[model samples]
Target: MKSKKKTLNDFGGIMYSTDPSFVYEDKNSSPVEALANNQQDLRVMLDKKNRGGKAVTLVTGFIGTDDELDKLGKMLKTKCGVGGAAKDGEIMIQGDFRDKVLLLLQKEGYKVKKSGG
Candidate 1:
């Protein structure tokens, strides 16, 4: 089994059990199926909340496996010619490229929305 950092929520609301015969089943054990490009509803926005006031084009609302997310992130970074990261179901491009990112996602058949100011 692959190990992931555990948080309180991962316990699935079961803190303790007195029963001798008990098992803890991981609900997230099953892999998530990647949604099709057309089925994906993506939001692009300019964010600067935590990066020392530096802006980044943040892409969210991706429903897919990590591999697919990485692939999409890589393509965006390459096309935009910038450094960025894809994690926690969000992509962070190192600069404010909201309009460009929106166009790129639209070209890829994803339902893209421009959000934030």
Candidate 2:
């Protein structure tokens, strides 16, 4: 009797490879390209939702850590002169401040993407 060996692709994608010694390598050879890739990863999504009968715009993104997020949120709220809160690792500001938020994020050296109309 022969035993059947399951391959990585047979089960799922690259993350579920059966090979224990598998190592993934990127074809991007330049360090500058890698940095650009990292920069592109920083994105912000703006969403408007009703909270307490008011429309609140939620800005979500990867901004290092909680401390950084808190600092940024505080700065943004102050500059925008609006009420907001940083909860659940996201920034929630009152009203539609997409353009203002985008400018603030750019000034802080983050590549932000504004989504939603």
Candidate 3:
């Protein structure tokens, strides 16, 4: 007989119990569809909101897993030689590198556009 598999959440905790009478129901929304690199229409914008007037390059419209998002964010941060974060389908780079970012995304074959004034 094959045993059922267990899913682990963050913090090394088991998300569901393996008890015979236990029932597991997922409460979160479905995951976003994984999009191909070339199909992603990413928007690059300059945002200084809620940052004390410090500008950040915000890349949104990424439809992929969190890992992929983080990887891309890391790449952008490295290429821009700065520090930032990636989360909620967006990559935030700590600077005003709109032109550089646009060029980099173009080289990577992603459909990128510059938004916001």
Candidate 4:
């Protein structure tokens, strides 16, 4: 008796048989390139508002999604050891962390620009 061999097509096509690691690597292979491709104007500003009677550093830009902003805000908060939030598609850190945030954003391959005094 002969047995039949299972091929990728037998499942759901090439994507199903593709190596998961390779898929991930290929997906994230050109993050910087993607960022550049999606580049838009970014404004890093300092805001002093009546809320809580304290000032906060605000970083606003045209990112793809709120998830990205949340992730960036979380990283900045952890690095700066402060509390922060991502709201209205902007990141708000709890201090004057513009310079640090700028450097961090640059490290993440974003073309950052400082705005305001």
The per-prediction CA RMSD against the true structure, in angstroms, equals 5.1, 10.8, 8.5, 13.3
lDDT of 2 by residue, 4-77 (tens): 46566544556555788977654533232122323633444555444556766677654344566677789889
Query: Among these predicted structures, which one has the highest TM-score?
Result: 1
How far residue 37's Cα lies from its native spot in candidate 4, in Å, is 8.0
lDDT of 1 by residue, 1-117 (tens): 124898778898888899989998886687788889999989999999979999999999998988899999999999999999998889999998998999999999999999886
Best by lDDT: 1
Q: Per-residue CA lDDT of candidate 3, range 1-117, in tens?
A: 112354576325655567989655556546668888899999999999999999999999888888889999999999999999998888999989999999999999999999998
Per-residue lDDT, model 2, residue 82, is 97
Q: Model 3: runs farther than 4 Å from truth?
A: 1-23
TM-scores, one per candidate: 0.80, 0.57, 0.77, 0.63
Give per-residue CA lDDT, model 4, range 36-70, as digits (tens). Answer: 51265567788888767777888876455556667
Name model 2 segments beyond 4 Å from true. 1-46, 50-53
Look at candidate 4 and tell me the lDDT of residue 13.
53
What is the number of backbone collisions in each predicted candidate, taken in the order shown? 0, 0, 0, 0
CA error at residue 23 for candidate 2, angstroms: 35
